[model samples]
Target: MEATTTSQPKTISPPISPTFRISGGRRFSNDTSVAYILPSDQDEVKRLKLNHDLWKELMNGLFKSDMHEQLTKGIRVLDVGCGPGWWTLDMAALYPNSQFIGIDMADVFVAQDLPSNVTFEQMNAGTGLEFDDASFDFVFQRFLVMGLSVEQYSSSVTEMKRILKPGGAIEILELINDYSNASPAFARIGSWIHQAMSARGLDSFIADKVSSVLETAGFKNITDVNYDVPIGPWGDESGEMFLSIQKLALPAVKVMVTELTDTTVEEYDKTEEQAYKEALSHQVSTRFRLIYATK
Candidate 1:
């Protein structure tokens, strides 16, 4: 968690206000060469924000830590890869006395109307963050596993440590590589995801290893919470949310996995259709893991 530079935290104003809409779900950003698997446009950003709401509902709250209850005046919080600032906005509304800052690679959907305590900056986490050491009371990251390359994982953990004050909390939530009890079609999609991510120099299996990385980076009292998120039209509301995420990610998944399946784009159409049917049958399950620790 060492700081290599003495640069102050810089807040750059976004050129355009954020806007969102639902479109054909396409992954892979046309704007940047960053090794991300998902697009950075408004539709994808909105989809990601919706995914956050689903997680919050499934977990029963915004955070699992008692520290969240202790949020008071003057507390500083940093959200890494905080797409659209949804979580930050929610937390800011709940804990108005605390200050919340969100940083992401793109400004696709940063809220224009934020509480006084909330603000957002556009930055890449893999590169060093522009913050002094021990600056924040809490650091939060969600679904950034696929956004960073495998080699950048340790440095990202270290960056979190460097920005967190003594006894500060760090919470990471990610979808694990494991898709248990899945039907054949869903399994094929899962396989394609793994291969697709690897092709982009990212690791789909990093969620399980995050705790060890945090430990090595000098974090302590780590706890890992795991949940099986049912995907399909079954399992009520949570399942519906999961199905939405899968469908939104399908277009990008199609491009990335077509070569791996040894099929032309035309031939892959049938595979996607069968996969959609399997996903609707309530037979697929994906594991979501949450790892939290103290610095």
Candidate 2:
């Protein structure tokens, strides 16, 4: 991707830390607007570091080609709900002339040092964005299920389209919750997690419906790119990657189950670990859908 240079350099301030809690028996934390739990905090920095390492391996294994090829130089890019700004930093490095703005509700895990062309903002995806209309060349949102509901997804898509330049592209990436290829134990665990997430207002499996949502938001030339991302604890190089993900997901699962139900965190962890072990016995896969469209 080529980078775009502007007269004004973007600046991002450090974000304050917030308290966190688990409301149900789910793995993801529900962060109140005033106070939030971010996995990238100093206390949980180890998890963040491991997650980033695994994420890099996962992305590399999944997309062998240059993943940022479409983001050309001199373009304006916006990443909504960017966590830790890994992708943002990678894009900035790939295209130095391009300006990247990453917006999230909490900035607990944002990089301490950002490149000159990249900036981050603490903002809610469900509310107002501090940007002008048609201000961005490309808008990227990934793994947003934790932060938005179906309605919010639609609204966010509309807002993204509004900020995108005419004929600009928007990419929405998400994972499917169902484990069609997983063992029965893993499938059951996945189902429970999906239902819990739905109850908490976040749908873990929304990739299939995203295309229609994008279409409803007045996007044209929409295309869906689907891939089966493996998710069992073992297999090959990718299996090792999945193992790391499963480890990282333990806390998020604890947050979800304990917050929503009467289940103890220890019990939930044990159950999830068993399910993950069973899942590894089979060739399990997670669905990754990348919906791309033009304004």
Instruction: Please write out the lDDT profile of model 1 over residues 1-295, one tens digit for every residue.
Output: 1112211222223343333222234434443335555666655665776687688777777776557555855589999988777788778777888999999877754545556998888788877789999999999998877788877777888988998999999999988866788787667767777887887788887898888888888899999998899887776788888888877666555665664445467655676778778877746788988999888
Off by over 4 Å in 1: 1-27, 30-33, 258-263
Residue 185, model 1: lDDT of: 69
lDDT of each: 0.74, 0.66
Across residues 159-195, which tens digit of lDDT does each residue of candidate 2 receive? 9988988888888778677776767757656766775
Instruction: Name the candidate that leads on TM-score.
Output: 1
Give candidate 1's total backbone clashes: 0
Model 1 TM: 0.86
